[model samples]
Target: MSLAQWHNKRPPAATGLRLDFDDGGSEHVSTTTTSSALSLLSDQLATQFDRYKNEMARMFQDHVRIVDVVDRVDSLLAAGDGEAAPDCQREKEAEASNAARHGAELEERVARLRAEAAAWHPAVKPPCPSL
Candidate 1:
């Protein structure tokens, strides 16, 4: 029932390990070895459980992040499709073409004006000098 009683109740009946010099002491090598091995196994199991839990947490986080990214991509695709309809694309292309044509016409006008100035001001040696 008590520590002293348990220790005192048993005689010097241990194996040859404790083996007192006067043959009065005792020891339990097998029992201690078995207990030590069990303790080590329990510690290893706890360590492995902790590692497994951390790995699972990381996996769940990554899964959540991937799901969020997928949701964003899906929404972007939905919005893109709605905004980039066929008519919208055609309109954008037409606008771009018109702008390019206008730019080219402006460039041609500038060139024509420069040539006219050069022909009208040959003796001046410089075109649009006042400008």
Candidate 2:
């Protein structure tokens, strides 16, 4: 029988899947069995879909974290580049000031040493060497 014929002939009380062929071949699957199988398949698909969603979310979060880290690093690098010249200039100024202070101190010590030397008189004069 054709599918339409089989559908028409189906008993009102029947609750099952029926497959009918043109040559009068027919197969009937119990509703309970089909429903259970379908339910199992649906459950499996739902579980796999959930897993896929979770994996995608984790990957997206990882990507965002990496992007954030890269952005922070770029900002720090930019800041460093901007500050480097001023840092160098400050260091140079400090070194110059220190050198000036050291030079003045040394000159003052030398002057003091000369004054001391000029005022000192030896208790005995050394013998002069004939040239």
Candidate 3:
């Protein structure tokens, strides 16, 4: 999965991410924002957050801060992945497309009927004498 797909943004044509090193060196990333990259970043941040919590526990032994941080992170991740957004727009677009197709079919049928009617003419002879 493309991490960028989470936001539905069109990927840039040139996604070169440049990183500068501390020793006057630099590296360029031709590709980024893949699922693996996101997973790695998430793991690293979680580790750091765990360390922060441990340090706070050592200093003040606060359990409330841990709960608060977990709740905040859960909500943040949900928002980041668009879990709170509705999928109504896609449904509406699909309905509109089906309606357009049905309208086109109706138009074609009407045109065919009109053409047949234009070619139709009254019978030259009377009804059969089967009566």
Candidate 4:
């Protein structure tokens, strides 16, 4: 969910009663008025939640990719003791290491973002008992 999806202003449907009044002295006079401001908070929040989940999944994918690379490298290193070229072995090891580090970094970022999102999410209340 991109932040762009959220509405910066309330929606027309979300509007509620807004009351106002005025008092006058001497002759004595009074006035009142009301208005409502709609909102799209719920929809925005849902989008944000979905985005968070998507990003987390992407992070998990990164980790899986790294693991796969490492496994492949291990296989190549073991399959042929002499067949594996020095440059090929070095490149595979480096690529595997880089992928692993990137995966870890992505995971860490996802965790922190999720934590932050959780903090901002509304508190859930217990269900009300039936009358």
Which residue pairs show collisions in model 2? 1-24
Per-residue lDDT tens digits for candidate 3, residues 63-116, read: 677888999998897776664345666778899999999999999999999888
Local distance difference test scores for all models: 0.84, 0.82, 0.72, 0.72
- Which stretches of model 2 miss by more than 4 angstroms? 1-17, 20-29, 83-131
RMSD of each: 15.0, 21.8, 27.0, 31.5
Kindly provide the TM-score of model 3 when superposed on the true structure, using C-alpha atoms.
0.30
Q: Give one clash count per candidate, in the order shown.
A: 0, 1, 0, 7
- Which residue pairs clash within candidate 1? none
Better of 3 and 4 by TM-score: 4
Candidate 3 regions exceeding 4 Å error are: 1-86, 122-131
Candidate 4, 64: how far from true, in Å? 0.6
The digit string of per-residue lDDT tens for model 2 on 3-46 reads: 99988885544334353343332333355667889999999999
Best by TM-score: 1
Lowest-sum lDDT 10-residue window in model 4: 29-38
Off by over 4 Å in 1: 1-27, 87-131
lDDT for model 1 comes to: 0.84
Model 1 Cα shift for residue 57 (angstroms): 0.2
For model 3, what is the C-alpha lDDT against the true structure?
Answer: 0.72
